[model samples]
Target: MSASMDIRTKSLSKPVNVAQYLFTRLYQIGIRSVHGLPGDYNLVALDYLPECNLKWVGSVNELNASYAADGYARVKGISALITTFGVGELSAINGIAGAYSEMVPVVHIVGCPSTISQRNGMLLHHTLGNGDFNVFADMSASVSCAVAKLNDPAEVAAQIDHTLRECYIKSRPVYIMLPSDVVEDQVEGARLDTEIDLSIVENEPEREDYVVDLILKTLHSSKKAVVLADACAIRHRAVPELTAFLDKTNLPVFVTPMGKSAVDETKENYGGVYAGDASHPDVKALVEGADVVLAVGGLKSDFNTAGFSYKTSQLNTIDLHSDHCVVRYSEYPGVKMGGVLRKVTERLDMSKLSVQKIAHVGPQAVAEKLEGADQIIDQKWFWPRVSDFLKENDIVVTETGTANFGIWDTKFPKGVTGLNQVLWGSIGWAVGACQGAALGAKDAGSDRRTILFEGDGSFQLTAQEVSTMMRHDLNIILFVLCNDGYTIERFIHGEEAEYNDVVEWKYKELVTVFGGSEQRTKKYRVNNKGELDALLNDQDFNDRKGMRFVEVVMDRMDAPNSLRLTAEASAKNNARRE
Candidate 1:
């Protein structure tokens, strides 16, 4: 026998059940829990969760479960979600699509019928009344980077490892379909000892040296240089490297909306968020007026770039991506961003860099007291007050709509992290995401508080997740903005349309309705600015134990200035031309 074949044969060890093999591999990684819903098809596989030393987080629905998993993955580096075929998997597809768009590493496992049933074309309960079992798998391929359907035991281990490796390497979602009978099929357990290759592609030595030298030369020669960091830095786990580069070169740094919290906001060189026309005047001047811009992991989506209003020329910008580096018009493939940054930082002569002293504007100061006796909670007063309430080591999650756009105005403190769905713009994502983020923080041994700023309309969509938080005893302080209806939708197209209105629910009664303990779960309703101010000042409320829910009542027409501007731009874009 050949040497390669002999080595492969010798690696096989004693046989173990397929479920054990799969869950053990997941456990070997950093995943301590699995977020999912139970169905008849996946019930047996669910049984293996506890056996493999993994906690099973039963979410209220598949979509919420997937969202929670996405949130967990963002903090824990990787997470998994298990759902049944057809209906269950399809329901979770939207969340999976969001994960893919945001570059979150999530493993989506679906339980399927037995291979015999699929071969014989037996009618399935979750199917579309058709015998075609491949339909859902095909649909999943659109959103996932890799797909694996385990039909045979001999190939199941290899398939699982391959799909998982792809999920980790690409930092995107991957789909794995496990037939009901195949869950118990025996597979060689020795393969578990062979670590899956999660390494990124290495750059060509000569090409990497040339690109780094060119970037250094351009930066050294530039009179005005700036650094723009975006969401990809966080997605690709390059925060440490980016931080090192920033520490070495004290260039002015500005982050995109999607890249908030990627850098330490307290740093003196950190300017602020840059969103083209929507950016602060100082930030706009530095980013738009720079002679040479080094953009690291920058994503220029329409919303992020303020409808493509960025005026910087590509010829003056050097874009560093996860797998490639673009120096002006020249592209160098396989040049990893983290490595290139490290090299550039090591080789660059700091004495020759830009010495222009740009004054850094700190967060806007909040008004100490409102002027009127009958003070109402409005966007102008609410955001700044909330910004003062935020402290270090807090994970802030904002729901899409007003909260998402409004949060951009709030300056995050040092060690604080911000989470939002900008590209997907999915409503009700933060509620479910809070549950997972809180749990992930606990699992990672961090005492960081998970604070969710949710919308009333968005909260109503996935309100059932509050019970899950109560069940897990997670420490999450939820602030629900009760604006009476869909405020963002009203700004987008329908100002006073009846379709935009949502049924008002008693927000304070949610804990009781969700079967939470009265002593452990605290609920409060704030109607005016004075009431909210008292709550913010109360140390007892801020230092409370267990889950605390607060509903802040506001005018239906009120919204942040940023959202109003973006909505106007969107409306103009949607208008029909003559």
Candidate 2:
């Protein structure tokens, strides 16, 4: 026999069910739970999750399940969601799109019809009336980095490994379609013994060194330099390396809105959250005024940059991205960010760099204090107060509309992880995300508090997921900002339009309606500052386990200052003729 044939023969081992192989692969990659809703096509596949030692988190709907999976992936590095073909997969497409936009890795597994049905061109119930089996996979191809339809047992294991590797290396969602007949097919079990290779391509040594030298030369030449960290830093898991670089240089570091909590805010050199015009005055000046700005893992989306209000010039910036790096107008491709950052830090000569003498005002010091015994819970009062309420290692999930924008001003303690879909701007994302995030936290053995700040209008979109959270008995604190209508829309155009108004449900009663027992659940409705303060100050409420819901009442027109500014900018951008 040839050497290659001998190796192949030796590598082949005992055959195992395809479903077992798939779930075992997911388990090997640290996915403790699979999130999805059961459907006829996928029900049989779901049975193997337990045998593989993976928990099944059944969501109320496919959309919520996808959102939860996205959240779980953000915390756990990667997560999986199983949905039926066509209808179920299409419903969850939006959430998957968000994952793609934000660089979150999620494996979207669609349980397809039997291979016989597809080959014979039989009309499947979930599919379009026509005999097309490839429509949903085509749609998923737009958002996902990899797409694989597993039918042949001989190739299923290799396909699964390839798809998952793409998902990890790209840090984006991947699609897999498993036909019912193929679920139990026999595949080599030894494939699981070989770890999936998820390693990224190494940086070109010469190109990386040239770019690092340019950055160092620029930094030494400039009198003022600043470090700006963004969401991609967190998505790529470059925080530890980025933090070490920041500590080494002691450069004034500021986080973008979507990148909040990327850096240790407690560090002395930490400036503040910078959101272009929405930034605190000092923060805006420090970043915009710098001669050389080093932006690491930067994602300059509209909402993140406050509708493109940033004043920094590209000529003076060094942008370090996941796959490449750009210095001023020059671009260096195939240079990995993590390696470049580590090399730069190791080679940086701190003595040559000038010390910047800028006044660094912490979030608490810059936050506006409540004025004159105002009873209403306004943005100015609420955000700062919540800053004090935040504990270490809490996972804070913010909804798109108000909570997403408002969270920019709130200070996070050390070890805190902030989850927000700023680029997608999907309104109902956080409720489902909170459920998945809580489960991910539990699986990781991190006893961190899972807190969600959701808007009334946004929460109504995916409120059923709260029931899923209750069903699992996951401990979470949900703060429903009960402003009568869509305050964000009002800030953009109509201040009091009927179209923006959402149906008012007794928010506090939702816990009971969602099947949470009163004995295990704690619910509160606070209409004034005094009432809200009492609940926040209560030790029992603060330290209690299980679900706790708080409905905070605010005026319909009330909004955070940052949202107000961004909304106005958005309106102006929409109206521009040129």
Candidate 3:
């Protein structure tokens, strides 16, 4: 027998290639899809994406892709999209700008021509000036940060890491430029780092003792101190702490349109959605008559704050936000709202208050109101029925107008719901987000039901997403508020006639058109309250099997709650002038 000797040689650690390392790092950070259009310059990076389990999402256009990525990021926490050189990058600027304005973390990846090609002027797809690639660099100032070229392949590793980290820290968009040759070159020393932590900083700002004192004193002074949570507050997830404080003080809470679900709308202290709309006369009166208003997570956007009412001098307001900054009446530079709020109960006394005051108001009361309304017979009435069909864990996305307003009255037992408040406030967000949310829910290992309530106008905007839904055989329900007009626009511009209306379609027919066979789907249309009730009673549509579409015919003039307020305000303004 011959003895075998084992020989050991040290493994040489070559420099990691830039393209493979960065792509792998992105996958580690939960970037499942790289949205972009392919160009010759950036094809090298695109080729390496699939190796890291990253799929390329081709968009209709660069701008739309950016918006889609923004939407995806809004739902998934981090968003990234790639494009080739100047034209593609420039085309995507608007969506990126919108993301920046909304404080969404979207990383913009642009693939540039190689250093040699740029020097040689090879008529690249999007090359502009040879001496200066400053267009994107200039635009970066408006966003959070921007970088061009990995330059030295050695610096590629740290630069990519720093840029992404800062993007998450600032909670805004960042631009990264990748040179073609660098991605294609064999990396000799690069390394794939551990997952990037994209979590936003949760630090509360410094407190303003004076502001806190004023707020607490005012709360003690008034019989009712209304806490009006705006859109920003709700988006920041301040609900639990804010609700606890309000309950501790036995204070009433009301939210605007953007703040619709800030707290369970069915709670006793919940004054209802307060930005005018069709809320009860008593609820509206409560908001109008509140002694002191605590505006948390607010934005002075035209729609929510009464078209920019409560200016610095007009109202005594204390604003709180996730940014940790507080601005009182828009005059005071403000204290940190989040920080001051956290410490509020510590300094204040709340034991005197009755904890039982915070009972969950039943959905029956809302149902009664829906049943009693006579003027506008619309899908707004069907929401309670739909709400009943939904489990506590269902995720709901509403389109614009009556559909949105109807769902606004819905009280979720437990679950998440969202609508697009920015980027054109386009109608089809429900369908689009339905796809996104369904994908997200599936990935999160939850069996939560995903529901989309779409208005006629908004449903048509990105109805194509439904095709994607059918393609994946996702189990989702589509409830179409088929009033057949841009009802929200009609209310906003006060244009009850002309271009506001839309050509109606058989909403349920879309399923068949999109390849959902009879066995795989069910469809229904409810023209009256009786039919709606009957449809709600049917158990065939309850289970998550394939897909379903229920179209509820509503009156076009069934005005939303916000429009009602706008009209009354307009009437009052005209009367005052007269």
Please name the candidate that would achieve the greatest lDDT relative to the true structure.
2
Supply every candidate's count of residue pairs whose N, Cα or C atoms clash at under 3 angstroms. Answer: 0, 0, 15
> Any idea how many clashes model 3 has?
15
In candidate 3, what residue range of length 10 has the lowest lDDT sum? 1-10
In angstroms, the error of model 2 at 155 is 1.1
- Tens-place lDDT per residue, model 1, 428-516, is 88998888888888788876789999999999999999999999888889999999888988998898999888999998698999988
Candidate 3 lDDT by residue in tens digits, 1-578: 11221111112155456787777777776667666678876887888888878767665457656666665665566668888877888877776776676666788888887766756766644656555554665765576555545756546777888888876656578888888877854443324535666555544233366666666675565554567777665445566667767656657777776776566654577766655434555656666666667778776654554444432322545667665444444433434455567567556666432222333332333354435433344544555556566676676776656655566566665445554553235555556557655655554566666777778887776666666667656677888878778876666565667788778887788888877878767888877776766666678777746678888778776765545555455455545643
State TM-scores per candidate. 0.96, 0.96, 0.79
Residue lDDT tens for model 2, 1-578: 44663564456677788899999999988899999888899989999999999999888999999999999998888999999988899999999999999999999999999989999989769978788999899999999999999987768889999999999989999999999988987778977878897776778888888988998899888888999999989998788889889888888999998898899877778888898999888899889999999999999888899999999999999999998899999888888789889888999898899858555564673335445444789887788788888898999999998888788767788889999999998889999999999999989987678999999999999999988888877779999999997899998988878899999999888888888998778899998887887788899988988899999999888898899999999999888896
User: By TM-score, highest first, what's the ranking?
Assistant: 2, 1, 3
For model 2, what is the error of residue 257's alpha carbon versus the real structure, in angstroms, after optimal superposition?
0.7
What do the candidate models score in CA lDDT, each in turn?
0.87, 0.89, 0.64
Backbone clash pairs in model 1 (N, Cα, C under 3 Å; residues 3+ apart or in different chains), count: 0
